[model samples]
Target: MDLTGKVAIVTGSGQGLGLAYARELARRGAAVVVNDINADTANAAVAAITAEGGKAHAVTGAVGSTEVAQALVDGAVETFGRLDILVTNAGMLRDKVVWKMTDEDFDQVLNVHMRGTFTCVRAAAIRMREQGEGGRIICIGSPAGQRGNFGQTNYSGAKAGILGMVRTWAMELQRANITVNAVVPVAATAMTETVPFLKPYVEAMHNGEQLPSFARRELGFGGPEDAAGIVAFLAGDAAAEVTGQAVGVGGDRLALWSHPDMTTTAYHDGGWDAEAIEQEWPTTFADHLESVGEKLPEEASAQ
Candidate 1:
């Protein structure tokens, strides 16, 4: 994990998971650029890194803006001479069900999580290609994107979009040896505060079985450090060949995501006939329910 002579930029690095990633990367010798919306937090992180004998600078700005995201990349190269790693860790949450969600809430999450990630990755990838050197692009994602959550339609959409972007960008940038990967971190952080109801669900998702309310307290929840290690690995040379992948990080719950089974083909030939399926699958709906059993509860599917 020695990143000596390498320059890294971590968005939202002023606190929480992003700060952990920046600090650990700097400790391993990467000259870090800590970006945050709060000037004081960003400055504090940078100062701490410097005090520990690491190279770092603070950039305070909203990551959701294209200008600020680009500035972070450009600032790294301008101050440190090159950009080697770009971590899109900046994010905010607006919790609401689809019916309860507002236009503003949806737009805000999409802007920060999806557009902000694209902005930094686009800027850094172009620079890396121009420099004729391989680079690492790491994005922070969440489990809600993989498995739909009850009240996070906006956040899920944005994070799912990130997974798609990472896959495509990996193919596009592979020629230049720049890898794009994402981490579905279930670690407790600021973002989790907005989804208090989902905390139990997340615990069940990690623990693999529903726990009694009294025993739930004993279920392990990960911290920022747990996520930072995986991010560091992805940002380092050790993971050079790993690209276009989404990895989940939870204590005792590290595994590739499980995709929704798509065996129910509604097409006969080259096209789908909605009318035909409506007639043919009169019993199909019941069969599907029996097939999935308790996983697809009647009340849950009503939504």
Candidate 2:
């Protein structure tokens, strides 16, 4: 859609990927509500948009709270009269392996990422349903969720939960014309710098900044704008037929999203035969792996 008169509320729009998405949307004629916990950053983003001849306003509040979520929706309606798009982009990280993870670490990540997404979506959907003109809900996901990360159990779990929620929301809201899709982006941002394991990978992504010598060996990293384009499309009429799907945007590549392989094949018939299972189960795995012309990797096969 052109979005000339639409209103968009983008959570965590104070900076980084969220700011890029909100600014780009406003540039396309949407009146944006730049929502962020940092009042100064949110206001700065709005000011920048207005300086560029676009309509935008800042709404500062915690994204994890229902009250703040409602306030953001209300701000959009109060300022622009109606809501057309909601970008649930607020998130934080508390990286730790599952074994080393603490209750506080896990709960904090879930609260900010998963619960925060629901807060904004729930509040926005109410407004969209009331308006009866349809709306867009675009969420931010991560590859860490798709391929489990080494030290980010909490982050991956929250991101994966979003995809599950997206599928359910699509089934319930499609008839109302509200499309809910997610963008799994691997862009360089401030969050990346704080993670010990991800710092070098992210620092290499700085557009005008210097890259470390080691980073020169890798292809490169993506900028925030690289992922914003897809979000804009999802929020517009161009993606009217797309819903309940996650798009992976990383650097110069985009992928048709896939979920984890959670299924295991076993020989079975209409009834479970103890004798058959005992006789065939041991050989099934070896035979299957051999058929692929390669043995399972030594580490995994040994296990």
Candidate 3:
């Protein structure tokens, strides 16, 4: 979809998936404000976009800062006259099992992915409301958040929190015509390369070796561009009605995620006492309990 004359801001866009989103938006005719903590990479992204006949400017700063967030929004309007889209894609990983994870690691991930998104969205929403043209706010989420990963408690918590914000903002901004959504992307970026299980294939790709067919079939479309298409679609006019969604994007696949809901419940006249609940526990909740990283009896043999 064409985004002609629309001005957009993408954070953490110095490289990887953020860069892909920025470049694609520019290619679709939107003037872009590329924000990154690294000045050199931000400048390079801007130069690349400009060289390809697209409009873009670099804003270098840590996205978690309120001042930086405000500057990004103001800079976009100052450079391009209006803000229409925001892609909060700035993030980092500090993977460690829960027992080993430091408070610093946890806070750092949350600061960038969670607080960074909040600050940027808060700033962009103000501008969009003032301009009287409702805008798109796209937050990048992760599969790790939806289904927990072994060593990513911090990252997963932050990403899952983003989806919560997306739903809340979508409802709050509906009257203003703004839509907020989350994209849970599985892409082979610097972040994904950190996973020990995926490291061999990532290195193989870098070395120009042909990937095993099964592996290729599963993850070949894990490139940033593959996921960028969905971001571009959500940012465009066609997706105005598609807010509050957590959409999965990966290798040749796009899927809608179910929102949290009460699946089942057990009730009694004037809630049961602890003794009564214990007596009925097996019949009320035991059989219906959700699995936590465990295989069902039917699938145990397959493993």
**Best candidate per lDDT, number?**
3
Supply candidate 1's per-residue lDDT for 93. 84
Q: After superposition, how far is residue 184 of candidate 1 from its true place, in Å?
A: 0.4
Candidate 3 lDDT, tens digit per residue, 12-112? 99999999999999999999999889999999999999999999999999989899999999899888999999999999989999999999999999999
Give TM per candidate.
0.84, 0.85, 0.91
- By TM-score, the best candidate is 3
Worst 10 residues of 1 by lDDT: 291-300
TM-score, structure 3 vs. true: 0.91
lDDT of 1 at 149: 73
lDDT of 3: 0.87
- Clashes in model 3: which pairs? none
Clashes (candidate 1): 0
Which of the two, 2 or 3, has more TM-score?
3
Candidate 3 — which residues are off by over 4 angstroms?
208-221, 292-303
lDDT by residue for model 1 (1-303), tens: 789999999999999889889989998999999999999999999998999999998888987777897899889988999999999999988888799999999999999999999988889998999989899999988777776677788988998899989989999999999999998886666676445443654556466664443222322236677677887898888999999888887554565654345655444666557876677686656466423111333332442
